[model samples]
Target: MAVGQVGGLLPHVAVPSTMPAFLIPEWGLSYGEAGLMASAYAIGYMLAAPVLTTLTDRIDARRILIFGSLLNALGTVGFGLLAEGMVSAMLLWGLTGLGFAGAYMPGLKALTDRLAPGDSSRSVTVYTGAFSFGVGLSFLACQLIADAFGWRWAFILTGLPPLIMTFVAWSLTPVTPAPRAGPLLDLAPALRNRTALGYSFAYGCHCFELYGVRTWLVAFWGFVAASGGAPLGAVVVSALFTALAMPASILGNELALKLGRHRAITLVMLLSAAVALAIGFTAGLSPWLTLMLMLVYAFTVPGDSGALTSGMAAAADPRFRGASMAVHSTVGFAFTAAGGWVIGVALDMAGGVSQPGAWALAYSVMAMGAALGPVFLWWSRRSGASS
Candidate 1:
């Protein structure tokens, strides 16, 4: 479970951390164009998630996981080798995104199915923690590699870990028969569940904020490093905050298990929103202060992500685990693409003005999304529906 999750999430974190800046000069992309490139991946992810999950129901998850991991690795390496222009980059990114969709949710279902049929929350926590840890580790590892070698090597390095993990999962995961279900019937009812819809909305908002931040954090820090004349490494500084986020994410799940998922998610959302508002108002005060606020926001924003997923899993019909997860991934990542594009638009509109202020405004919009997320979750709970 850990290996699969880490493999799945490594690309999630590494791409956002490195790609925005890495492809900039190489592809001669503007901020909007870079954002679109990121969106290209999300678009592919959204499109493939459901189809792959349906496939998982017919194929053994272990086999699906291994194949997915190989695809993910192949896609990443292919992107590194073949992406030479804007169009080509988008095409490759979409393929990489398709690979990601195959790996992430299917991998989770594999872990969940393997659970020992007791209170699965603890196992869920561990799996989710691996995801958060992988994201943070990806940022840290990729940043170091990018600094030492180059962005191409960073992709190579990120791709290798998953390829290795693929074999590990194949060797370790117990074999099981493919689940039986009518694919359309299994998926249709999930779409109508109000709580599920609400959870999906909150997740979308969370992704809107989370992806916006992840996609831009290094660039934001780069701007800070240049303007402040700070001696810190931009990527390193970004990695520290991202790494701080991992524990906070684990803690959020723990808190949610104690407090009701809705309440815990609401609290985290509010806190993250406040931090975003603070950054918007005070970003130019001092570099350390600005980074500090961002760190605080980062820690809180993603903390509840696992809780949200776990809640969705619990709320879902046991028979439709794969479909439910597919829905979850599709909704979350679709909104993520929107969030990236929106931030890019905000940045473009800000033009040559204070770049930090522009970024602050963009980030503030993300915070608003975070704030609004809880309302949907709360509504779901009040409606007496399971997410």
Candidate 2:
């Protein structure tokens, strides 16, 4: 399932990974417009996740997974064959995000539903790690394909992988979810689960910072390369950034286990904020320094992801797991959309992407989001959230 999930994610970042060099020039888009293109996906996910993920409470998640995988394939391939400019690109990419909204958390719910209770937390964490690994592969594969066969083929080829996940869904043994007691869209139960809400809100903050950096990372590295810093191509740096997050997420979950989830997540978010701020201010130095700091930022940034996910899963009510996941994902991706767009706005307002100060302001935006995560956790606890 993990491998198949990775396959589904191959096209996940195809646009963002290649957008700076390809779409911006081809469409004559400003940084803000490009960011809007990226945010479109998140907005699509945000709009669809609550409904799609919550449906798992009554139906087999496998059904949703199969449908989602096919939609992802369609959206991705459609982008390759049909996209012409900003509007079309955003629409197709948003379709892809909607598809993913069905696949990701539903797939996780499918897996956890079959697992023994004792194994749920670790398995959830590992699956989330696989999510990062898949995203890293997306960066690498999309960039290489685009470089070799133009950006269109990048979308075309990467689109094929999601089809693999449909077969995985078909092979899964069908299991009914726990019976639900309320309306399908009623998020009140999830909202009332303060323990899960804490982790979900923290996940939102994490996604805000993570997606903001990810949406602009290739362009930022392009800046670094142009400024005579790291000469590494966007492909290598972007791929490495996400790939490093895989182990970082896994290890972070382990740290959370040992140190307590709240303390560990707090420390990691603080560290991530510090590193992001450092990157903003000092990344234009030597090539090696820039590369090193970026790698570190990558590690620090996603370090809380698995912990946050596993914590939420562990805390959620079994009967309302689908609704809980919907809340978690909706909040996370809502912030994700805002993060991607806000950073670009920051760049435009701070004197365009060429200015170092613009990049600094962008990083500061990410840093501010990360720094607020612990506060959310604190608030959740104060509100009587307990696992």
Candidate 3:
């Protein structure tokens, strides 16, 4: 189920990379408009997470996962076959995001409910680590399919895997009894847990930085690849970097255990922010060097992902697991959308996409959000203790 959960995301992330070559040119949309359309997916995710995932407290989460997977399959297929403009694309992608809201958190709840606390945390780390591989595959798959059979075919064919995943999850995954929390929609328990809320809100800051980086990474690499006359394409390099960096999330969770979650996340954010701070200034440097630095940023940035998630899930009251996840996704995805949109706006402000300095400033904004994460956690801790 975990593998399938990750498998489903493989094609979704591909849309960003393909939009430049396929969607924007064909649909006659600017990059800013395209980013906004992409933000629609985040909008859907934010809207759907609390309502859909909360159902797990009443019914088996496997059922929710199945429903979500079906929606994902339908949405992806709809995007491929029927979408003709930004509006249609936004609707389809939003539908897909609805599917993600159901699948991801519910899948986590289903698995964690059956495990020992220590084991559950480890499982969360490993499971979230699969996201890196999924995103990497998305980039690679989109490029390969688009090169062979055009971009429409790319979307159409890539949509099939999640459908297969729907079947895999429904037939093969074990069923667990529903968690009997207060009511199906009860979030009060989760909301009242200061620790859980802190971790969740911290996750929001991390999401801002993470999504911003992932969405624009290929675009940034395009300039570097062109400047170097590199044989490898931008998507390929970005995909490889994302894949190689996948294990860092798991390793980081281990660090959380040793150093404490807040400290570990804070340290990682500072390091990543430093890289984001410097990458822009060196925009005119050698493309090879730029790629190396991007790889560094990729590794450092994702390192805190699993740690943040594990911390939140661990701190949540058992009665409000679903609700905790609900708050986590709602806040996290709100920033996810904003991250993508702000990156677009940031690009426009920096003097459009053509200028190196603009790209430099835009890149800096991506990681700057995370630099505040430690401070947020520290202040929360102090306030709670004093009160």
Candidate 4:
């Protein structure tokens, strides 16, 4: 299933990967406009995740997973062939995000539902770790393919993998959840559960920072190279920055198990925020220093992911687990949608993406978002009185 997800995500960053080098030049897009196109995927997912994830409470998630995978393939391939400009690109990319709304959390629910009853904490953590791995591979693969075969084939070739995930979904043992006790869409219960809400909110803040950095990291690297920094493949650096998250997240989860989820997560977020500020104010002065800080930024940003998901899962009522995840993902992706676009707007306001000051301001924006995470986590514990 993890392998399938890896494949499903092959096209995850195809646009951003190609945007700096190809799509922006080809389509004559401004930074804000390009960011909007990048954000369309998260917006689509935010729109659809609630419905699809909520359905898993009373149905087999395998069905939704298969459907999402198909939609993902359609949207991705369609973009390769049919996307001629901004509007079409946003619509198609949004469709792909809609597809992921079905694939991601539903797939996780499917996996956990089929597991033997016990602590699935590590299992959940590892699954999210796979998400980072898949995204990292997307950055690497999409950029490489675009360089070799043009941007069209990058989307086209990457789009094919989700079809493989569709088949994987078909083979999963069917496991329909017991009939849920309330209205399918009643998220009020989830809202009232402050413990889960806290983790969800923190996850939202996390996504805001993580996706903002990711959406613009390649472009930032390009700016660095152009500004007399070391000449490097921006995409490769972006890939490495993201790929490091997998192990970092796993290790972070393990640390949480020992230090306590809240404590460990707070520490990581605080540290990450500090790094974000450092990167903003100082790192760009030297290419090697920037690379080091970026690698550290990667570790710190996703370090809380597994712990947050596990905390939310444990906090949610069993009967409404699906709905809980729905709320979690919806909030998270809403921030994800905003992250890229907000950073892009910041870039424009700060004197465009080419300037070192613009990059500094952008990273400062990421720091501001991350700094809010621990507050949410603390509020959850204080208000809910949950351990």
Model 3 misplacement above 4 A: 171-183, 385-387
Please report the TM-score between candidate 3 and the true structure. Answer: 0.95
Off by over 4 Å in 4: 229-231
lDDT of 2 by residue, 126-190 (tens): 88998989999999999899989999999999999999989999999999875667688988888
Question: Which 10 consecutive residues of model 4 have the lowest summed lDDT?
Answer: 224-233
Q: How many backbone clashes can be found in candidate 4?
A: 0
Pick by lDDT: 2 or 3, better one: 2
Q: Clash pairs of candidate 1?
A: none
Question: Using alpha carbons, what is the TM-score of model 4?
Answer: 0.98
lDDT of 4: 0.91
Off by over 4 Å in 1: 13-15, 19-21, 173-181, 184-186, 229-231, 352-354
| Residue 346, model 2: Cα distance from true site in angstroms | 1.0
Residue 225, model 2: Cα distance from true site in angstroms: 1.0
* Selected candidate, larger lDDT, 1 vs 4: 4
Q: Estimate each model's TM-score.
A: 0.92, 0.98, 0.95, 0.98
Q: Which window of 10 residues has the lowest lDDT sum in candidate 3?
A: 172-181
Model 3: colliding residue pairs: none
- TM-score of candidate 2 versus the correct structure, residues matched by position: 0.98
Which 10-residue window in model 2 sums to the lowest lDDT? 282-291
- Please write out the lDDT profile of model 4 over residues 187-250, one tens digit for every residue: 9888888999999999999999999999998898887777675646687798888888989999
